[model samples]
Target: MALDFTTTQWITIGAGAIVSWLLLKWITSPSPKKFTVKVPEAADPKWTGKVLENPSIRDPSNPSTIVCYDPSTGYLIDTVPNPTVEEVKELYNRTAAAQVKWAKTTFEQRRTVLRSLLAFVLENQETICRVDCRDTGKTMIDASLGEIITTCAKLRWTIDNGESVLADDYRAPGLMMMYKHSKVVYQPLGVVSALVSWNYPFHNAIGPVISALMSGNGIIVKCSEYVAWSSKYYEQIIKTCLSVNGFDPDLVQFVPGFADVGEAVVQSGVNHVTFIGSPAVGKLVQRNASDYLVPCVLELGGKDCAILLKDSDLVQAIPVLMRGVFQNCGQNCIGIERIIVAAEIYEKVVEEMNTRIGKLRQGSILAEGEGVDCGAMTMGNQFEKLEALVQDAVSHGARLLRGGKRYHHPKHPSGQYFEPTLLADVTPEMDIANIEAFAPIMVIMKHQGPEDAVRIANLCPFGLGSSVFSADKKLAEKMCMQLKTGMANVNDFAVNYLCQGLPFGGVGISGYGRFSGKEGLRGLCVPKAFTTDRIPGVKTPIPPILDYPVQSAKKGWSFVSALNNLVYNPEVPAKVGACVDLAKANI
Candidate 1:
């Protein structure tokens, strides 16, 4: 057989082949080179050890400035301006105005902005981690895992999948409306607001910004006053990224203040709000957003649990358990606050964990070498509450295996440090078992069986993330299904969050709505449903029998009933009778 092609057709085929090859290479290429950042032997020489015990305190002289300092080394970081409520409103207005123009930009333009941010993060991963460590009192390793890596994953996922997620979705019009076309067009929702906590300052600040800009909306981030120092630096990074990408930097804004500022942001007339904080504060945000009838997504506190069955692999599970409890100085919302161990291995697990906890060296990460296993807590005010909870638990027959109180670090007495704690024989009746002890305390409860384990795990009001470990895959899966949480893992812990495609959120006191993944990106936009004629000349016209004049009301009713039956009836006889009746009614 012989085939011939025109020159134009050959050129088109060649161009398509080249494009396909280039796209394949782009998708399969390895990620940017990951640099190994070394922990500094000492704090930054610029740190003057001038501690501001309360960063939220307004400078009496200036009244408009917040005293920001390092929680770890007690070093004076810097002072950030505390914007007034009126300033917050004005900031939101400017952001909304810029969003009007941004919403008109193409997906490619948005991708460029995200790519610039991704590149900035990759190039300055060390600097980002250092800033986060300074502000949050977390170790460099913790910052790498919680701040740098998570932010990069989110940026990468959004850049690759955001356009498709926001694209118009064509839907079937059904048989009766076959001549019509229907679709859901995702459109921008103007300005959105996020009130983020200080734990993962960099990640929290950048996360909402990425989603909002990708969905063609502006964002105003209300950062915690505790991390105001780092928030100022992050705000500069975002603005610089936007400006260099030829975007209006006003499209994104960061407001750093106390409760009044957060309340102002929620009621700032933004189209939507996302809040990440305590359950107490989340309720306030919801109430304030209700004033404008604006929708909100709240990611609140959690008492995440890990259940270890008798047959579970201790070698593999112990490391995961350690990381899950001690990560981010146990300030993680999803960190395992409770551990349910089978009675058979309960004592062994306690012994193993206690030995590990004894060796954990805690100090200010910024003060010395990388030998420290855990860093200082972000806030010292919570120490009293945490101690009270532990003491209450001890009073209730819980065995305090090790570290029952706060530890004053020998090297840095000013720093907030809590000993890595291991408390065994924890019962549901104990206050510590039911409350969200967001600290380094590891509470272990004995479970006779899977049912008892689940009961203990679900005792807390929070229903966030959970983990079930067992050698039997079937049993593990079954128990995981029974756990009362938004997300669960079998033989794993917190791996769901590492996979960026999965939505992250919870139920009950943990709060409602989802963030991350496709659900999150779409949630930021309005799903506008629209329909039009499928063919150029095809149209729907009002029938004479059912016209507004209603010359024959009885006939109009009969006509509608027959039409519905003809389209919906499954039996041939019924459809035939309906057709006949429709004809008679029309006449």
Candidate 2:
């Protein structure tokens, strides 16, 4: 267009054009291309769902029809279906069938398979750690030390020493039975049902199986439903090893489910049962086993206590005790839930603990990364329990030293995260004092002396594990001997359970029996007594003195009297004369 304008008018026209161009660019832009890095998908999208869904159903098109969630984000990880009642029945059948053949195999053959499993675990440790960390909401360090490596070490120990442990034990025949040879032989209990806990899923799942298989019993591991994903992969590894070693894969199978599935297995005519979980549930398992008179081992939860004596060095004790308290986020059954400190160091220890707890980092637990100290709670109810415990204690006059509530991260808001809570002035009457916190909560109680510390530690019904931290070795040993725990750690804590050679278990409400050592290996088998007459042609002989009839009247009475005198008389010369009389009567 042929138009004339002043210089100011031209400038106004240029500014309007610039503004319009900028507006147009903003409208038509690609919105800064929202930066996102390409990464491998963690789990199959189709299999993710609520845990309560019917996991028995399988979709042919999908990798898994069952679903489980990631605790860190409350998002679906993947579903691996728990067994239905029918499936559990099938598992029992398979286990029973496998037991027949497994029991027939020699101990060497059984040891071979166990060694193979250990080798597989050692070889696939990285994969195991990753799956464990993902499924349990624990750090890789925990999965590595607590689950994979620890289990492998146990398996190695089992393979090396299980043979002699299960061998026939010979007994010395008493003087009365000098003419007979006595021996005790171990026989396999047919099918063993192992109800594994979720906290240390890998270790708990495989531990009983090791003993059961080593003793020639077929085992079916019923995995916790909350940690089905880890179980699935673990089952795969075990089955693969079994198949490769030419043993029946059913010798050790995993049936995943909730409490119903575990109960079903217990009620399914299994020869023996082993359960590792809470005391309430352990009692249920015992009751269930009682119906059939099937012997069961219950490794229940512990309110493990740590005692810091007046002679304890704070520098040496604090880190070890904190690790004992907060390791696995205090989800460990043997973790230090209660700390009884001497009055001399109660305030100092509590103050230092609170300060140390504050320095702990809480966030999304990563499988591969470092720097995360505390992670999300694996189960939803655990978060609630932690909150309730703290509230209950605080309401009951307990002083909250640090972290009195739940924690939330901006990026991982859905996760069940809690702070490392510390409480002081906790009394025996308080609910938190008696209960297993099973979280990163430390309860501190002051004691008058070493005896008071022992008294307080022994007050709990649970006797799984207790510890004494002291600079005095002799005094600590004395305290350890006095503690009624199944196993006691002196100076350090909780690591005593990791010793493969030591027997680990509890007494009273903490449950009964032992595991992880010679007793455990032998416990998996039934004892059979064998006796044979050492004298030739003396078969089917019973002591004539024990016969019902009082034959030879006076002579028989005199012989019996003389035998009693020989065995139970107080004076030595009279006993000698009675022995001579007894021999003369026999002659």
Candidate 3:
């Protein structure tokens, strides 16, 4: 017998069923206790941490506390007192004093301090990894490779190579000015305000600090408020390294605060600034720096792309291509956001990528276990952004090849995890393709030819990085050259960025200035050209030959012409005669 029911009654039943399923899903998931850091009491005499806690260092009355969370489990981790404006100013004042002393130190002394830091990082690598993992929600492997290893490598590189790079360069005086000896001297540009981003906190902060200190400049690192735990840990270790090396720990100050403190730092008369964050905030930094005439090095956002040509080696490109998007859960500045492929090979590549992304293991955020290719998103707020982008793309006729929804596991109910996602039929007109989605999402766009692929890649405003993979090395190189980016790779992704000897920065809307190379070490310095009269047994005339009132010295032009002819004249007799004439005319 068929029974008739009202449409509203069926709708109510459907909604109730959906709620029941969600409840069941939540109940079946594993639960874990929230992680928390023990805040030292005011009267605790055993608090031996390096962070300042003076009597006057209390937070403002009714100040908003900066509560931190473990992104892996969406659990409360710890809370810290938000620094007041006055406190940030005090920190800067202290760093200024420290800079004066640090600048006076010898090159060997600075190198020693840097070497000590390298040693500390190596010895405590595992501990550092755990702290960073807890703070960032990235896998242990990422923390080890990206933070521990990279930070130590940068420190060692700076120590071993910094002196020679920053050495006083002597230039030969021109024949026209024979007595003048010129020298290019690189000097420290006082204190540097390093505004660090939350992602890859350890390496980014340590990288600039090593360069700044090795170049004999003081640095005040303002760590992200969201990840203050990692900053505290780094600060403690850095202070110990500094103290043991007979240097003032304040030379590298760590001030943990939010955007307000960062703003104060910029306007507080720092000699130079280096900021790493989104382009919007970077623009603010530039505007602030302009007020004080302070130059800045900004590593802003990136919508980096990769072009998979028809002749590309799919076997070789699969792993790197996957890692390029999934690594750090796609929170990296240089991570690939879009892929342009030749239409002939596009379908095959899309299927292969879909299968691989589908097979990727989503597990606990801890680095202890194996088989987890991805971890939770470091920032919980990013989940909403990722969802919005996916929705917008779907609405605009884009198709999700795989993994567009939030990921859930029975063992981690509250974890902020997004499955590795792949989207196809993406176009330049879609918002998802244009925006920098700092999540584990990869968009594939089809192109008719190599030129079309290049056109698609260059359509974005960001020019941070681009990569191309082709069986023909020369073809790949040629294509990569046409890609507008500060760093580009042929048949590989992020290889240039990983090479510490090369400059890692961006172009156009991605921001400017360089870091991680000789240019970076020198960017924190003030170059002064020193010229001196060094010619022996030469006495200057009372009136200089090139003086303004040199109408009486009309013969000087003849001497200049003779000197020019003496150097360039091919004939031996002419050269000899010209030299003789130059000396005679000058006399």
Candidate 4:
């Protein structure tokens, strides 16, 4: 029934098909431009230590609100509402209600919201970084690297591959069930919650939200009270994106308060919870989530280790070592806390670390300028603990090569600053070597060989991330395999986080379950197995031999055994025998 066409008509049809194909490609392709953030060279001096007369005041006039301030200089930021348990419950209710409608939306609609958010983040990169710096006291460069780049990468990844990850995954039916069709459908959980950390405020808050929305679940983020100032801005950005995209703004909520509020979030009848913070608090979250029988994905702290083999390239490894220890003032959960160096290159590594660490200026980067390499600590009280750890190590025969105490900033005397520290000859016995030091202190331990390096690296109770540096690729990979960490890099440090496709989480005290990659995106959903008939008018049926009123139990067993052998037996003679046995059993 084919119709013959003229040459001109055929050419016209081909031209139309080409145009449609081109249009579809253009529509589907992601934006080609790479998002960039401009790191400021200097900050205004006035902003450095501009504190209110009563900077520590917690807004006594208004009990409903909690005061927020810059931990670096005690500068007062705006106060935000502190939600009560009842308020937290209300938030969950609202989000859950919105999710009911949102779950019905098409993938195109979810992508539209993400595209809008991507545009907003790019246009307001400076504002976003500034808000994070103001609240967390991190440097502009740190904010650009940790906040801007990671958030953009997450948004882009989710937008590009989220639909495919959440698509119905078909499974092959075995020979015994050839007439059956099976698939796993990823359906959204009504509501999900994330109790994120305060280190990278922007990324921590936005990351779970991205997964929640992409998978069609509403999320309530319980942010760290330490970064409540910036959480408000992030909340606005997320809600505005949702509102503009015609989705209910209540679909995304941010709760900022004390521990009680966080407890409420976990016990608020949410379908799932994603918690990122210290190990101590993670236990509490697990306990509370247990009451409701709610499942949780906990991404807790890590005492990550970096091993430097004798054959490692010092030229390339030195910079990575410095950044791994000092980035975000070493507040990173997966930051390299201990450096295990081969005995051959132990002295060289220590000397290089000492020289570079001595030159690093510590101050309030937001108020100062490019002169400062390391910024202030968010938790000033941790200074006492850090000093105690360092003193303990030094007393145990560990040598303090450089700064190991708190740095008193001349310009901003009240600012919270820890000196960039270098501790050499650290042993596995010292507390500093085993404990998680979320500060700008580099601890180096000498290892006799590859086995010793791995032994020292795995000594810590926490096993989140690890790195092995060696010129010999095979040796490095072998060492990485032996390291007891969730994620290990052969020649780099913490670069696994940049590749959004890989699952990001850890084993042991680092907590359980993942919150990134396909595992994470689908973690927010319920994977339900679906089955139906592959052919029309064909279906599964109960055989009389296996029915409720079986006349003879031995005959029924023989019938089932013969059927199994006929379908699965490898030998042709065995299969033929089984078929004959099956015929006799049926008769």
Candidate 5:
């Protein structure tokens, strides 16, 4: 429209055009600051709900009490009281006091209560799903199943298997008339501080929460500030469930805020602390626990891997890998951010992956129509970190095969929307490929064989979960054993099996303790072994028909059945002794 223009004016106009183009590209790209998804109504057929309309907060004067939040919509989650060391100490004392009653409750009683709660959770699965959806901004379907159903499954598994898991015990018969009666018993660790992360706050945190509760411990939770509302919803439902199921209402309580609040609560000397979070926080909690001689279960971060063997069906592998990468929009702790593809068909697999990656419909998550396969970054930091990783790869000469930009779903530009991204030609040296990209970005790399694949997969500071895809029985079995992770999948996504009544934990930077399963009970309990004699005044010692039973004088020859001998287990017995001593100190 201009007949003449100055150099400076043209420059300004050009710069503006470039800036506008960049902004538009960013706004229209697959990455958005925060994306919101429609909270689902159910984890199963019985679940249902709508977004919460308006929720109320707790009365400041009585902040120790919690206000029930709607399960349909996570609203007004928790209100923190000004907690002090004395209050914390008193809380622990009360927890200890409560444990006696709860522990005395039969395993059937605990199981009965948990079974009722499980049934209720399943019945209200939809409401729980929607609550999670509201809290995490994940797709309702994923949140419902991942958070709600998974939590319910874990609770049910623990209830069903808690007693038997603790029943198996043994003892070694010492040489001579001496014997060591060895038995492993699971007792509640008394007061446990449950620290939940923001990512999967609704469901994942509850696994340990229920586990601790079923094992007869009082759990005080420091919920994620980012999704505090969900914490409130949990307190509401769980408290009601406990009351109805005949458990103490004080068993579970919610504390809200940032690190300062968490520190204050942690420093209060709770009996045991169970934390699910990043490595930094995990270390801090561990340090605090060490100072107080309080036991803690630290479940930290993960840079999980997905291995594709030569015989893996490319068709099945593609979808499995897709879900592994994109489920929870890549925010899952077990999300397989790095894929190790076999070199025999590396290009073929990458090509197929690219084709399927294209079909992941990126759109407005909350729009009325059937939306995209994914949603957005649950946290703003995650969004920026993902964006930086893509830029870093580009700067380092790695090719961006699928996504190199951010975008809002065309219909809902205002919502957080990120196109699922794929990067190829990305070497293991690239930080994004090895570091924690806790977002919706996935980097694909090739591996020559199982040994090489495992090497690359294990080349990380974090070892949590891993999945191996192959039809070969021998290779799958080998990988399952050799894979360096707390949990390994032979032919499925690592997070798919929530019903297995096994502990879900990690190694290295991933976590230090196990949750769910049988180990879950042991993690939150003390193993107290005692040797007792029926008669109070009678002193019994190892006695034998031989001249002397080792070096004992007290007569118990009636029960002597073996000849005198020596000690064994070598240094293992000493190490075990040290561990037992440490365990006793922790309790």
Candidate 6:
């Protein structure tokens, strides 16, 4: 028998259809976007009709795309002088030639010249700051003092600390009448290629260069096209300043190049390559390294998480979370991209997050210290990509609790700025939270409990940095252990690892080799050993057994020394006292 639909069942089906249609309409509705216009110069404004007008592109064969900007109008300035491939090659050859002499110079000689260069950098802070602001769209306040100042500090620190890594370690004279010996020391490699990013141009370039150079290696630095001029010419200015101070200008050379040049620079049979960029390009560098079998340090992308559980202080967690996501317009590799909130505090956290996001005041790039909340993205295409991600998430059922739109001033239509935006109801299932949005947007995800938060946080393919906000010490400890990330902050996001003298590297898709801190410094070189010998009847303790038969009279002393040293220094002995001291300690 066939079943027939009842009147109540038919009415229920009709109601379901109406509800589904209404839901579809709500999802497709156009969310309104607002903007505030900003004009730089009303007195006199000049528009350059060329995107490649940066003077650096002047060379025909070794052409470059200029990154010039008019500060008054936030307009892409004009063409300047681009360092051609020829210029890049010339710089490479110079560095290659000078590296031979530089590597051979005594540690003190290198140290002296490095110090002089640091001094030169200090003297040119003003000009460097202006160039940084114009080239990359970062305010001078951030670039010069923030980026350059930190770069200078790292330069001096790397120079000073580098010696310790290369310091010649000697093994004490061993037992065969000082005839046998072993040695350990730090040896320098040939030229190294440093491929840097634009976010923190100066610091990004200086850190790797300092480490590689201090290890007695020649280096070629490839800057992001966004700020290639800044990175390439910095060394020249320092060299010019140092010439008067009489530092060896030849020891360091900076060259500007494109992606092709970057590829060529890394593939040119260099000793090592240290790269800080996206994983795709990093992989390219790593593959390039395979040809020559050279080692590389690749710092890539990260989808870091920030967890806010019950009882967490909204005041503290709120600002830190915003900073973790919004710093440098949310372009940081280790910046917070995911916010996992515990159900108990989910609504409260969302309310507070919306308040903070709402307070953001978008403004021109030149707003040095303006109360303005954020600046334009340095990379224009990045803005469009970020917009698409937000729209996709909205279309896929994620509801925007706040800031789901972009604002533009009609007058300055060409301005690259985007509004500070936040989205709530983001689920792990949504691509919005899974992939990285390298822009000024933040996403908040809800969780049933701490277990769910941890599960979702660890779900991403990335494992760069993570944070847990809990008054409970045990929970914080446990979460840090469970998460598969390189660095985790208990009450904070990342800002913790910056220049704190700690090693920082990602675990999963982040990258391969480590840099910064002990592991980083050590990664720049290989360890070597040194050995020496001492004679028989040398009161070598005779294994603390005077009656023991000798393997060989000549070899007897070595055997005894090895046995005695085992009781004392498991390595090699520096002094009788050291041996005796180590023996008692180890024994």
TM-score (C-alpha) between model 1 and the true structure: 0.92
In model 3, residue pairs whose N, Cα or C atoms come closer than 3 Å (at least 3 residues apart or on different chains), thus clashing, are none
What order do candidates take by TM-score, descending? 1, 4, 2, 3, 5, 6
**Which segments of candidate 3 are over 4 A away from where they belong?**
1-63, 367-371, 539-587
Candidate 1, 282-337: lDDT as tens digits: 99999989988989999997899899999999999999999999998799999999
lDDT of all predictions: 0.87, 0.79, 0.79, 0.87, 0.68, 0.68
C-alpha TM-scores of all predictions: 0.92, 0.85, 0.83, 0.92, 0.76, 0.75
For candidate 2, the 10 contiguous residues with the lowest summed lDDT are 31-40
15-109 in candidate 6: lDDT tens per residue?
99999998997597443222111221211212233333222323466355555453212554544454555666677677788778767877665
Per residue, candidate 3 scores C-alpha lDDT tens digits across 32-123 of 11222332221121211222211111235635566555566544556676677788778878888888988988988887777667666666
Q: Provide the global lDDT of candidate 5 against the true structure.
A: 0.68
Measured by TM-score, how close is model 5 to the native structure?
A: 0.76
Cα displacement (angstroms), candidate 6, residue 291, comes to 1.4
Off by over 4 Å in 2: 1-66, 535-551, 564-572, 583-587
Residue 136 miss distance in model 6 (angstroms): 1.9
Model 5, residue 466: distance off in Å is 1.1
Whole-model lDDT, model 4 = 0.87
Model 2 C-alpha lDDT versus the unseen true structure: 0.79
